[model samples]
Target chain A: MILPSAIALGREFAGARFQIAPVRGLSVQDGLVIGSVLVLIACYLLPLGAVVALSFLVPVPGIGNYWSIFQNATVHAVVGKTLWISSLTVGLTLLLGYITAYALVQAGPVARKLMLAGVLLPLWISVLVRNYAWIALLSPGGIVNSILIRWGWLDQPVSLVRNSFGVVLGMVHYMLPYAILPIYAQMARIDSTLPHLARSLGASPRQAFIRVFLPLSRPGLAAAAFLTSIMSLGFYLTPAMLGGGKTVMVAEFISIQVTETLRWDIATTLSTLLLLVTGALVWRFSHLLELATAKPKT
Target chain B: MSDFTYDTGYMQHLEQSVRRETQGKTVHRRRFLQVLSALGVSIGSLSFLPSARAQQSELVVANWGGDALPAQRDILAAEFVKRYPQIHVAFDTTGPTPGKIKALVESDNVSWDVADRNLLSALELGRQGLLEKVDESIVDINAVPSQFRTEWGVGSYFFSFVITYDAVRFGSTPPRTWKDFWDLQTFKGKRALRNNVEGVLESALLADGVAPDKLYPLNVNRGLDKVRQIKAETIFYSNTSEAQQLLRSGEVSIGSLWSTRAQGVKEDTKGRIDYHFNEGILLIAAWNVLKGAKNVKDAWRWVALSQDPYLQVALLKKLGWGPINPAANKLVPAELQAQNPGSPENIARQIVVDAEWYARNYFEVQNRYLDVLAA
Candidate 1:
């Protein structure tokens, strides 16, 4: 019985040794691909995982963090604000971007190039600088306020940067590009003659646009809305700077909680919630066209 | 679908997008790691540079982002090397204290040997057991203000949070208290407040008529309500950079800003701006040595040199941050007493933030505060 057991053990050892051999050059290309994919996934998920882990960890084990969401009035309010801002930003940006893209397609080549250049110029300048510029434009003593004051539009410098209006304006300015590019790309692909032909056939411009153009541009519109929503939801500096003190968004609130209250669990909980919100939005975006255009099974 | 490609411009733009996206993928895959490695080399060199003697290992000292940080750090470096020739001091900078310390400690890869953390974060980390208690013998705590020195941080006083405004904008009637700030009808057009909790709450309560000395065990609900009330009307700035820019550009006429930044505004404008100490919040950045630091002796010597009044005064004059060393009084020929936060007299008036309290309650208050604003 001992001899038979030893023989079986030796066979198992030999099999294990056999498994270790000839991994040599066996598709290092495949290994590289697999390794690269693993690294990329790890890179993406690890930080997110850590954030989630941090969220659930304190108040000494339980669903304390998740439960705290209900207890914390601030978290609930900020989340609502985030949703409102994101929706408004997406809606406005898509409308404006579509208009600009349409205008670009209609303009003369030189005019279009210049217009395109103007549209993309904000992309190059710093967001901080642009936000500051907006502040300058909106402040009471600054250009806009000075002009409004001179023009007798208002008695004093209206509070712009410190309010939600300013926040929206600045965000829309940034989000406009997100809306513009995709729609413009879609519009350029659309046949110019379709609208012209519709006009010749007695279709009004509005009808032609609604019937012909809107459906064709669904992908771009979806894309623009999706992109704008994601960006608007995650904005920290814009709301913090432009909103002044009156408006507090999720990002600013998270920083405040961590720094001022030292409530690590709550802070992480909020951050994790934000991540989930954005992640869900991203998932929605990735499947936007699919969900919107899905056909019923016969 | 085929008729979609419009003109040359559109085609060119499309081409550019395709090219850019393709390049982004390449950069993300291969170039990202390459660039990271390259940056890692430079950053590694800065933070772990070998000694000139090639005998001793490196001690990395991480600090803030600014012209002033480098200037102060340079003096510390020179003096550090003068006394102990064997050891080398390497410096690094991370953007903010809370996020950076959390990242370093949680990652279990302590990238920093020593870091610049303020009183609040220092105390917070000390409670969390993230910092190594300073070697008392080397630190010479007797030279430090008893109030300033703590188990976690060695105080090198920076600045007080002073309310600075455009003198031209405010006229003779400057803001005397947080109440002055609350009365937006008189002090109109966007008023500013720092986004952080400790100071803002104190200011809001002070505006609500809470005495500075009695600020702590702060009435959280009352403070949150005040914050919401002010936040409903006031604009908030999070970063120092944003606040300074807004003030300089005349985007904001009145806001609570760093004393150094406020002083810079005053000095830059030849006193066109005025900084009021009526209800300032005192904050100081303290040097903290990490627990796992490989070069403790070197870090201590560096800390010792950093304690010098000459160096401190030079730092005071050159950089806007106030010097902690009482000896810096004369080296700084400027009459800092009444004006600068570091000055002996100015330091007395401002509310001392109970950082220990902040460390404990920051998140709860911040969340509540934000909620109130959103509401």
Candidate 2:
């Protein structure tokens, strides 16, 4: 009986050793892919998971934090203000970006290169540096004011920086590149002859351009608006700097809760809400785009 | 559908990008393990290095990081090392936020032996048991002002949120008090206040005619109402630098600013800008030994060294810091007394911020204050 028990133990040990070998049927590429996925999950997904979980857990379990959002008038005002500002920012960015992209596409080689460089140069500079530059240019005694005063543009210096106007200006400046790039990519792919063909078919220049060129750019326009609005919704630094504490956006408000108040529950809850709103906006916009583009060509 | 080759379709593009990224993965196991071991060895050795020096008697001090922080550290370390020559003194210029201090202590890996923190922060952390006792045996409690010293920390220096204005912008009648600061009709142009609820609310209440002594258990509603009156004209500054910039650029004619930052503007503008300490709110920064510090005894000694009247006066003279020790006041030069928050005249007029009140009600008050500001 003792001999049989020893043999059984040896057999179990052999089975355990066999299990330690490389997983069967997994090629090197498959192993690499699995490892990559694991790394991604560990590095990125886990921390995000913690944030979501903490939103529910802190300041007592349940939805007390979320419930308070409705009770507070300030959150309502801030959310309303953020949405309004973002919509304005999207509109301005889309208009400016379309014009800039159109000019870039129409310009000669050297001019096109120069225009593109001008558009992208601001992107290279640090956000803090850019904001500071805006402050220098827009402040009451700044270069722009000084220039305007010297040129007799107005009697008193304009209240440019540290207001809603300043925040939108800073945001539009930051977002122009994001808007322009996608629209430009789509514009570049369009056949340049479509508008000309319409004109040749006895359509007026304006009519041809509106009928052919405008409709063709709808997809790009939608994509640009979607990207700009999403980016605008989460803007913190530019608004904080240029808004000058008056025009408080959602991101800055969330941070104030985290750093100043140390109410992690409120911070995480508001963050989760912002995330949900952003997702809904993207979904709604994508569906709208699908509906618009789904129509057959005339 | 074929015309939908916009960037070759988003999904296909993502797949191609992933393929491009994975194609660069020629990681040999030996090389990978060697790199991993290299990282491990460096990190392991780095951890061991501090412990090895701990055996040799060393103390690490942490403070705010900036261009000026190094100069401040060098001055303090020079004085500290003079008396304690046996123990090596080093400085870490990572600013001590409550979050960072709590993180270090909670993780049971407290690298900071001594840290410069605000009085309220020390009390809050002390209550949480994240900081050691002040070691009163070493740090002479009697020398420090009764209000400044605590069981967990000793005051480093005193500063104030005083009224500063652009001399060019504001005519002869510059705003002198918090009342004048709130008097938007008389004091024209934009006004700036610290974004935080601390000194800001105190200023608001003072402007609202609340007595200095009666400022505790702050009338949050009245203060908020007062702030709201000027909220349209006021642009709140998040930091001292921003406040200084607002004053310097003439974006704001009047600003509620720290004495140090006001002095900075005055010096930067060659006396074109100035500040008055009338109704200034007093704030103190204190030094505390972090809990589970490797060199607690040495940290206590360092804290003790800071209490020396001579060193306090020297710091006052050099850095414009108001000495915490009451004895250091007599030693301060007459010319610097005007800038010193601890001076008899300044202290008489200024309100000492109730640190105990703040430590207890900071979060709840701050949430309401933010709401009020947002509204």
Candidate 3:
């Protein structure tokens, strides 16, 4: 009886398969996919949805919070400063990171290992420690000034830390490792002989680098720029500590609102705006990445 | 092929066992899910459990941590426990910012019984109904000055933002007033100011020739203008420790620093750094009870115990904090009298911060102050 039923069921399954190709029934994999999507909704989207809802509801409902964002001059100044500092940080990080990545690509094995260690070791240290170290080196009576003064380089100690320049410097230091790894990874993938091949073909070394090497490194440069700029936009500690309370960024402004002023509406609104800006940036970068990768390789 | 069995009974047995195994797995999976859901519910509801029951005998005091924690534990907690052995005292070192207090009360989870915060914060939170009123019968309401006392809280201690100057830099003639601090030609050196509105605005006003008695209803524009005059030469410190470092390292010749931190810096530099209470902006730190505190009785008792003249003097000695209880002034040693902010001579020279005015205008003033600093 069992054999007859099994044979009948197999025949029915075979008959159904003949109707549509690749139309398989749900299985364990499908269950897993649905479960993960549900988890994402519950954990990530739900809390974010609450924040967005709060932005509209608090201090009386409607778009009042967003309107305040426009009317408030402090917010405008802070946002403008953040954008300026972030752009400066990105430009400096990319230039310095590209040089380091190029050196890493050209170094021999032992030198490469040592150089890699130099780049990555600071990441292992705490950001607080690193920023404080910068202070110790850059302050008026700090080591840098002491050395300069001893060498008769100046009449008085120059102000180094506690300004936009100091903030950018610390930011560039932090962002270098993040930028270097990606650029290094991309540069390492390029054929080592390509620039040499250009040199062999009667091209000057400078022309070879500009024509052959630089174009190949565009994707990595773009990735590094995108990463550094996004990270810089949200920086709080480096600017707060090194900026001497002058370089107020958006993150610190939001913090002041949340903790000091107790203006949850303003904090949430700024947070939502930051999220949207980050999302837009991610969207724009993805397109750039696509364009970079889509370009024909020389 | 010769050994293979094509028997219907054998095939039927195999199919039956497979069906039984899958059925067992389904039952096991269902049981596991049931247990998981039960755990989730229990864990989620745990927050709603009556915290008061577990904390009946225990009182939690929250304050800004650092040196104050040890000083509080050794002086205030030790003395309180001696008085009531049955009660246990605990501490939450996370500073009780107004934001945290508001959140705790609004969420109906008031974990801290006593919170050490500023008079401005107490006024703000008290008006919002987030703090419990001080029980006049239990607490000695008149121990501190009437201005420092309120229905919602009492002054726990006093600290002032005094002019701290590097004696090594300006040993002959130190800055005694905010006007001298702003005098670049007479006393030319970099200056440090706290990057907050509380003491800063008052100092700026005082420097701009606004009399101490006429300081309230602060001329913010005038104050900002005075601050901008020295803005290029000033480095604003956000934390008290940063102020100490700036002065101690000779980075700034003069700075406005909390009296406690100034004292520490003076000691650290062996009197090379000195601060005078002259023209200081005296600020009060208050002890407030949370609205739904579990150990309200114990909290009141703690506040009352903290006001003991001897204990207040001990706290002053240990932490350089000025005693809130005026009675503690007589108990302070002659050597410490000059250093204490509450000393009659010192208190007369300084102006107490107007908490009522600050509570009303702090939010806007702080924003403007930060804007000026950033600019």
lDDT of each: 0.70, 0.77, 0.83
Predicted candidate 3 versus true structure: per-residue lDDT over A1-298, tens digit per residue: 9788777666666555443223368555665677689768655664465566667767777899999888888888889999999998999899999999999999999999999999999999888999999999999999999999999997899989988888999999999998998788778878989999999999999999999999888888998888888898899999999998888999999888866887878888998999899889898886655544453466
* TM-score of model number 2: 0.81
**RMSD each, Å:** 12.9, 12.5, 12.8
What's candidate 3's DockQ score? 0.29
Model 3 chain B weakest lDDT span, ten residues long:
B23-32
Say which candidate scores most in lDDT: 3
Best-fitting candidate, scored by DockQ? 3
Cα lDDT tens digits, model 2, A72-191, are: 777887888899999999999999999988887778999988989999999998989988898899888899989999999977998788889999999999999988876776676668
Candidate rank order under DockQ: 3, 1, 2
**TM-score of every model versus the real structure:** 0.77, 0.81, 0.84
* Residue-wise C-alpha lDDT for candidate 1, range B52-143, written one tens digit per residue: 22223667777766766678557777677777666666666544365555545443334456776677777777777777787887788766
Off by over 4 Å in 1: A1-39, A56-63, A104-129, A152-154, A181-220, A251-298, B1-56, B320-334, B340-344
lDDT of 2 by residue, B1-375 (tens): 222234547755465344323221211222223343644633232121121222337687777665347555667678777878787776666466665565566545566788877788778789989799988778787777688877888787888899898777676888888898999888888898887888888999999999888998888889888989999889888877888878777788889888867887888998778897889999988887899987998898887877777878777766667888887888998998988878989888888998998889887877676676666
For model 2 chain B, the run of ten residues with the poorest summed lDDT: B23-32
